[model samples]
Target: MGTFDAEGVYHPRPVVADDLDEATLEDAVVRSIVDFDDGDIVEGTVVKIDRDEVLLDIGFKSEGVIPARELSIRNDVDPYEVVSLGDRIEALVLQKEDKEGRLVLSKKRAQYERAWGTIEKIKEANGVVKGPVIEVVKGGLIVDIGLRGFLPASLVELRRVRELQPYVGRVIEAKIIELDRNRNNVVLSRRAWLEETQREQRGDFLANLKPGERRRGVVSSVVNFGAFVDLGGMDGLIHVSELSWKHVDHPSSVVQVGDEVEVEVLDVDLEKERISLSLKNTQVDPWQEFANTHHVGELVYGRITKLVPFGAFVQVGDGIEGLVHISEMAVHHVDLPEQVVQPGEELWVKIIDIDLQRRRISLSIKQAAEGGDVSAEYRDAFGEHAYDEQGNYIGYDYSTAEFTPETEAQAAWADYQPEVEGTTTADEGQSAEPSDD
Candidate 1:
């Protein structure tokens, strides 16, 4: 057969086609079919969606079968949930012909192949990848950024998160910290992204915070050394030393996680982006309170709380302790504080010096023996008759003493007077480190 073209050229068909047999015609049709190999990506339209698999028409002799397992990065998902009939999708050719003589394809693998090329470029350009959290695996989560991207639990937030399940289905942005295509590994850090994005906000927060200024915040976390308080914009650390006016054994003993507290800003390091806060500074200082009510050369009854090599700590007021150096323990030479007084023993002592700045009080048992004006806290307990015109302790009979508030207070003062000498005990001596303000 021949046909005439618009250019007036005559085209004649080959005589070989006119003599072709049915077997030859079938071979020619087979040769015209499109072909693809393993790992080759192909575009197709979803033709059938079964419970176990999806059939995609890629213009091949047989429809490609995408098993439900290969439909998505997620496991155990229904084929209908992944794709609908007549919907166009891309899939990677897994096998030209399986044992069942069907072409096998993987949608997830195709997506992974495409994603890797984009992800590598992003990593090179220092870009961020965002996706929804698909699963919570051990020690981390899996994000579907076209492929399974591993987001570690520790990198999910500025602080390590103990519960990762809540992150599932939540879309988050992250920076690629590590990537290895051969191992099928992609490590991400959402914390890196957060820190980069919040750097400016933190700087502003720190700039506005001034020393000695008080701010209210919620305790975000508690650690052995300190507690971190979230002050709206950023978190600041309250060291254990500044947790209380009195000595604190642990940060938890004073504040717990989620506690609302007023804290004083002690310092701010703009270069380091750190804030130092003090919980005690916002409260009354016990040392300052004791100093206001007491003075030098006054007699105050106290209990020997601890005996150290250099001194003995005497509890004079609530949460207030004064140190009696070994040299001031008595008029006579004393080798150890325990030689002049034993722990838990009660006696009167005179205040020698008070250093509010150093948070220290010096007491002297030897000077107290000379007698002085009793502290106002205990002056009422000692009747005027108990002291001479010179304010020296004279003899008083307890048997004749009437049961009154003064006597009750004196009784509560415990036993022993300033004139009493140290008594021996069989108990072993103990020592303790002096506390600081």
Candidate 2:
């Protein structure tokens, strides 16, 4: 066959039988490629694969060579992963024929066209897709999402990840965040995928959850106000006050991050998606039990837990509270509570009052202040003491062993007029007070 060149020169390649026969052959050739429009995807067999390009036979007279640059949508993917000899492939027709009489084709572009359709439908339906992490670029990662999809770093994981290299070569599932076929832009997010999935699941989980139900969870975070625990698929807030029976400034004082814990669901607000759980609610309340075991006017031993300006807080029973007033330190007045009471000191106190409704107990150290039955010993050692044998001492303890009055009683022998002692004897006693009776 002979064809005219662009320079108006004629070249003879082969000779045919007649003009009609030549026309028939040319018609057949044109008809074979008539449906092969530009951008249309067509299947072919790999004729050869080389470092520079791959040759494919798509029932065309001339084998088409796809350039290495066109083998993959990603810049870093090795061409060897794309094709092998004698393997079937689909490609987009770049042109019928180029200057070299060779068919131009692109496998990546064909896949790209199909990807646009699939990605558009998936994105519209809010569906998920899986792919491998091709590379981690600035602010995001490139995933081979049947196409090069941009996944923001913020959305790469359910939570933010510091290192991104570990994600490479790993397959991941993600939701399509954005998609544009005209501009060939696609954005993906793993976080959104997980959140959407969990949102659906959490609704059902809450539907079955009820108050007073016990469940196990992991401590997600320990904050000052409370600890947030993740109960399998949901999270519950454990207030600091309900964390334990002991006093705590923060939830971390008792529970730690990632600790497995059992909790009772104290409250649940489905509308707000809130669950109030308690770690201490499972235990028996000490104050409730103490009501039956003890009563007012009974002597109970306790330790000083804390002190305030007015009184000292004493721990009566397991979580019970009792106040010892400053005046109760002894029968005498006390200027400060700390003067006689120290924290953690053990003392025997008489229960003066118990407000069960308010969870409070009033104790008096003064009622038991006499050290119970020490009267006889104090009466014999008294040095001008005015105390009755019932353990009442008017003066404070100044001397080492006992309390002595500021004034001494008159000598007993002196009351007998001291035998006149020279001048005042019987004369001073008889006529001194004649007028008054």
Candidate 3:
């Protein structure tokens, strides 16, 4: 019979001389035994599988024993599930012989050893690694790429995911961000892979998305300052100011996650990979709409929304407000807007001037009290009794009209009041001091 060498090569026994000594024959027989030490990797075939371990025939005098714990990186794995009988495999020598006089091998360590070199090369070349998620660890997922790899939850997708359980058993591709063979650690980022693959698509999308162009997108996330919209290829930011035509308390109030909305592309920063969107732009500008329908000297009803040091903010229309300066609050000298109007008080206000460019609308409660032509919106509410055929106000009870500010420009200016109390007039030259609106 032949004996296996250190390299597992079979060699026939040397022919013995007729006068050979017993000690010389013993030396020759011992030399035929395969030479191996701990840490050496060896090839073998599965000869037996038990609940606790698998036996491998590695051409050694005795079969090598692989404990179930060494079968896979996963904990509490069944040995039978890892390997079947007669399957060829590789294992790392852990012990020449334990207390039971058995050769112990580690399959997982051998796999890790082989995978380390390949993983290092891939990381150096900036290549992607493909693997199946084997376990869900704290803060990340574990992938089986011959060896265990960590994929952080934050780097799993373009956006951070809160749940990680669904990733187990799924094969995925990722970029190697960090590798430490000494520590047996490998960190991967699927987001990096996704971003790298989608770069060209994002560029094309940004190129085609022009300013003022309307787009349909889903709200991916809502932050305190803005909402992020997924515009197919990339995410665009809709600042809180652009979320709606009126003051927004928070971005979430205007848009929630997963809400489909039509938005206007305000700006695109290719260098920064940023997209600025405007939700209010796609819809009609309440200010523009108000300007188109209302004009100077038109009477509208309003509710005193807020009182500022310089004037009062009056809501005249949905999401629209106009400033009633202290000078225009009443015909007489007024120390404060509160002297003429209290919050929640409903009254008539005359549109003094509409500066569409500056987004300011000058309104006057004094002029409204003096009586003027009611706005088109109120003309119907009062019927023909409030106006003559010429569209001029004949007579209407100021206490009963339900007109209100209908311009966002008026609303924007409601918070900004001029320190100097002055009249807002129909003549352009007589316009009040332009406050920062």
Candidate 4:
């Protein structure tokens, strides 16, 4: 029996137990039980996995129930795929006690909360975030950067990538371009990261690049003015004029997108971050080659490329054209070049003057027709004479010559010649002559 002493309260009997340790054990159990509230993040060990839910023992009064949908940011995933039994994981308390008196937890929200803090720090530091592409949505992809992050298709690469399915399951690095915690929206750009990396690479590339240095590249894009080539680090422009040794009407005519080409560095503007490239400069100069093998006073066959006010450009070699002045088109003073020779007409022409230094060659159709040795003035000036096998006077007959199909096919100036004397000409125009400089 026991008696109450202090306040004159009634006494209750105390039973004497075989062991007093049970009372201490019950007190220890009460102290071991942890208390949690909604939105609290708690760590636990996965105790069991089920078809639609997972059971985690967070040392609460009851095991915490995590629905499969709340297990991961990825939708329609199996709970087993997200967590395994005995694995330690952190979860957010969704409900201290659900309708069934069970503790409810969400693994995804906990990860999301932690991710936001980390991402904010990364964004401030201008660091890159990497994650796997989990879903392919319209206009973009969903990357698992702790939470779903949108990566637009246009900002996925340096160039727009039409096919986004290939990106699924691939891990990629990106910069956080936008962040909205209230809306739970995050926008990412892989291109930004790539461009930043390329900027550094471009600096190094530009520093080492020298004019006239040959380099290999891939044609990235072709525009009206020029084609842009990716020279490993930066893009250099190949102007339409420098695309070919022959005259080029358009950059696409010489190189197409995705074409691998060898190019010469014509100029490097570090201040402007511009590079001038020449595709034709990397190849042999047709004019130089023709000058080496051909000579003044010799007769060569050519097609009338264009009939200008002053002259007709005649193509005698690949990428090489000589001007036949209107005065030299015929023995009789010619008012128009088309009257004596029409564009697209194959003809023989005599080279009367060659300025190798200037890359200009003066040709004569009338002189080629005249039955005479090289002219006295030309012979006296250049000291070369045009003679036949019997040493008789022989001049080329320009009117009777025909071009081989292969030659006509390869000629760049075979398209549309400029009109002469109000008549529409059907041959291609001559390309602008190479700069003497």
Candidate 5:
């Protein structure tokens, strides 16, 4: 060793250049190492590897010792994989001197100091945090984003997740939905994945629908007013009024969840993002069939269903019903419909009037004429007939065979000509063709 004087000239101290005192040098080094303190964050070059500890040289007389546990932040990891000779690593000094007079250093605490701020920034921005699934815990799994994060059993997805083992040893990106640094806990979620996807699907669904389009869907859900159906990817509402031409009490009466159905698109409300569908619109309207099939004076059998103050409703067919008013019930007189027939009673009714556009049909039981007197004019026009209690004609007026008039004047005059002889005329309402007399 050399000493520097005040004038900056060096003076050498006595020393044996040969046969060096190795033992005294070792003793001084040990004494200097014991004087060092722990809990100091320091930098060092990886010097040596002993049986279970890593030796680092930080320019101290004696190198610091980091046992296998203190060597890395992760569990069950080999220190050789993280550091090598000549590799410069920084660590926190844990013990000034251990029982073996070795300085103890830890790599994990050194890493933690650099990690906390980065984690906080990611959480504040509501950004995605990347991590490795390091361990599987009781209610969730642990991840390493240079810090411990807890992902709950729930919130794993938009739907519930049943198995979590497959997540281990895998690295994934998750939204930091919850964070608390004081307790060193972090919670993450994949719900953002599901919501974003459904939003996309909803937009696609709206684009696919339009008015008067015939399409099919499944009954997705039932409410008091209607059923919500899944039309491919979108949802539509089948309102109760549109369910049937008949009567519908509730949607559940005819539809159920998961039931596949065909529906007609009646209207599209883009502003409200709603669709109105009709089940009955997809079928043949019976009132339309009735308009084409029946006429005045035509006889039809119907089952009495509902009674009201004005009339009784008779179901003639699936969706066709006629109302027999109280006045229409008697050629003579009647107080109530029940006075002529009871509900569920099947009877012959004559079509008195029909409004195809309004879907109303006026029927008369009295037109059957079961007991009321038939005028000679009607008897001659319609033939001999029996009347029902409500005045509905029940028997054929056979006078079609006995009457004939030769001319227009003769035909018009036939009714007034007295029932004295044979007659054939259209004013008597004869057929257009006359038979040879």
Candidate 6:
């Protein structure tokens, strides 16, 4: 062997057989280093992290370089956030060697390849994918499910959620509705998952519900005919007619959306998935209460509310009315009811009849006024002309007498007479008609 000094002088040295073999072995080891092609996935340890790139040691001749953009699927990420020194991770080979002779690698690409296989298997098994909401975009949201999954706004909930901002950072489970490998697109629907879950719950709710049972629920919506109430598992309808004992013009008059109310189950149709509820049945009936305390021939004060050809209706109490037939309005041959009574007129009446089963009451104003004095002024003015118990004239008459003070009174009475066909004087049975003058 020969050696060179620092002064560039050649010197002779002793040669060993082991030294000659070591030189030959080093050359063979260098030639035997493994070669890797583009797109190969390799495991490595993060050796360095910088602002723009990361260095990974994958047992290669040189450390692999992963640019900042290739570190994660997220955009504008800092290398420090995606990886740390000495952390084991998998990377995809982007290039065997770049122009600078450094191996180019991508951590995000390796994750994408692994995620595609996992998602396919989940879909085949009809499994659910859970992830956190990452971004809110136009018409939808982006969920991080190993990769970015698009969840449309309409399919986010059972009903469309108006505010998508609140969903950000929330973990949710969804079903895969669409998948395209070539386009790298995935569509998810949370509504489908919810509907399926609710259907099972509804079946159990319907089985346990029975007629005449009371329940508490929230009013979900009001329609012209009824209001729909949410009973936790399903929605039941409260018809307008069943809202109150009194007549209701519309369902909104009794209940509005989000009102909490107690209701009774009136009926249920399992085949059709329908439930009928009654809000009034849970309260007291005013008509039944009035009937329990009132009876026939009892005097009550009321106001005339409506008039028809048959009779007049008077409201004696709240939601309680009694009809007075025209024949009962007065003790005379009355041609019309309005001649004696008018709408909005308040008066006293006696209940003549009651039909509790039919919910009817008959009243009479004339009968209630019976046995009262005719007129106090008329009695004082005609004291001289007395009448018997039958109301017949019994006093003496002076048709052709002299003009005395008493004689003048008798002459004035001779000219007056009653208009009845047979009676020449007012009869006790005859009812007095109010004078027009």
What would the TM-scores of all predictions be?
0.73, 0.69, 0.76, 0.80, 0.54, 0.70
- CA RMSD, predictions in order: 11.2, 13.6, 9.6, 12.6, 14.9, 13.8
Itemize residue pairs with steric clashes in candidate 3: 301-403, 301-404, 316-404, 316-405, 317-405, 321-410
Residue 229 error, candidate 4, Å = 1.4
Q: Model 3: per-residue lDDT, tens digit, 265-374? A: 99999888899999988878898898888889988887889999999988888887888888887656788776666898777788998898787888997666455677
Best by lDDT: 1
Model 5 RMSD, rounded to 1 decimal: 14.9
Instruction: Give the Å error, residue 358, model 2.
Output: 3.0
Q: Over the stretch 268-378, how does candidate 6's per-residue lDDT look in tens digits?
A: 888878999999999887778767766665555678999888779998777789899998887676777788778997775667888878878899877544322222222
Judged by whole-model lDDT over C-alpha atoms, candidate 6 comes out at: 0.77
RMSD of 4: 12.6
Query: Which window of ten consecutive residues has the lowest lDDT sum in model 1?
Result: 428-437
lDDT (Cα) of model 5: 0.69
lDDT of 2 by residue, 94-199 (tens): 9877888788999899888888888888888889989999898998889997799999889976667778988888899999888877788888999998888888
How would you order the candidates by lDDT, starting with the best?
Answer: 1, 3, 4, 6, 2, 5
On a 0 to 1 TM-score scale, where does candidate 4 land against the true structure? Answer: 0.80
Cα lDDT computed for each candidate against the true fold: 0.82, 0.73, 0.81, 0.78, 0.69, 0.77
Q: Relative to the unseen true structure, what is the C-alpha lDDT of residue 210 in candidate 2, on a scale of 0 to 100?
A: 92
User: Candidate 1 — number of clashing residue pairs?
Assistant: 0
* lDDT value, residue 400 of candidate 5: 76
Query: Model 6 Cα displacement at 115 (Å)?
Result: 2.4
Worst 10 residues of 4 by lDDT: 428-437
Expressed as tens digits, the lDDT of each residue in 142-168 for candidate 4 is 999999999999999999898899999
lDDT of 1 by residue, 218-262 (tens): 999999999999999799999999998888899999998999999
Error of 5 at 324 (Å): 0.8
CA displacement after TM-score superposition, residue 204 of candidate 5 (Å)? 4.2
